[model samples]
Target: MYELHTDRLTLRGWRDSDLEPWAAMNADPEVRKHLGDLLTREQTDASVARFQAEFEQRGYGWWAVEVRATGEFIGFAGLDRVDDGMPFSGVEIGWRLARTAWGKGYATEAALAVLAYGFDTLELSEILAVTTSTNMRSQAVMRRIGMTRDPADDFEDPEAPEGPLRPNVLFRRACGARV
Candidate 1:
């Protein structure tokens, strides 16, 4: 039942209705361009399951974002524990919206809200965001939300293959930092 609302969106728990669109978004080449290879339906289902479990166990995770006025599920934006073995270990804020939702400022809007939740409600000291070096779109969203990139924090993502997808950049904003 955890929910965070902004002027036009709601970030909340996943629902059975989200599965179809979630799978479609995962299967989209354009949307998956920075995220890696397109995922099979089964793979997408497994990811949704993991997201749901994280929320149940930790009270916060990647939330299913919807257009508040229409109740249309657009994507997800929220916090996640950075897996161990990454150069930087901490909570990271991330988003993946359907291509239709792109260019609408929804990512920045939801991210600002999630950042507030992390710093104010969760009292996290910092939040990080990572994307492949070439993903200018996501990097723009990171900057729009007041995160700064330090070149020294960039690294080869351990989980990605040794190529275009591996060279990743990290952006961060400390709690209470200007936004």
Candidate 2:
């Protein structure tokens, strides 16, 4: 299984038991604000299945993030192929956690490790992260992880079926480079 360790987090592949908490996170309105409408439990399960399949086939995907000290499933953070009609296409680093997990620096910590894994283990040339224009928290995390914002590269998300949330900010980091 793919696993990444940081001072307070463990990033690994998904588990069946993670479904409930993960779903709850996805279902939280506040957490889903920038992400648009909250996802149903069924939608969350499908997403988990897709992540697992991607990990198996591509050898990389969003890893299940856990609080190492408490053994709690915080959420997921790692590398994934954007695979959509966005400006950044080849690969990206992304994350999502429960509402209670916010403002804890967990996203930044886990993201750094995952970005390292992407450039080191996966030998990626670069990784990008995209978030809605209003999601300053995630934008800050992207900057904290050494990614630079590229307004010229911004594009609408083709995957988001829900309308206006499509316009997003694009952040990119080159391999072996740190901000």
Q: Which candidate wins on lDDT?
A: 1
TM-score of each: 0.98, 0.94
**Residue-wise C-alpha lDDT for candidate 1, range 1-179, written one tens digit per residue:** 58999999999999989999999999999999887899999999999999999888997899999999999999999999999999879999999999999999999999999999999989999999999999999999999999999999899999998789999999999987896
Which regions in candidate 1 have their CA more than 4 angstroms from the true location? none
Clashing pairs in 2: none
lDDT, candidate 2, 1-179, per-residue tens: 67899999999888898999999998888888888878999999999999888899988898999999998998998787777556557788899988889999999999999888888998999898989888899999999989998688877788776566887888889997856
Q: For candidate 2, give the lDDT of residue 74.
A: 89
Q: In model 2, what lDDT does residue 134 have?
A: 80
Q: Model 2: how far is 140 from its true place, Å?
A: 0.1
TM-score (C-alpha) between model 1 and the true structure: 0.98
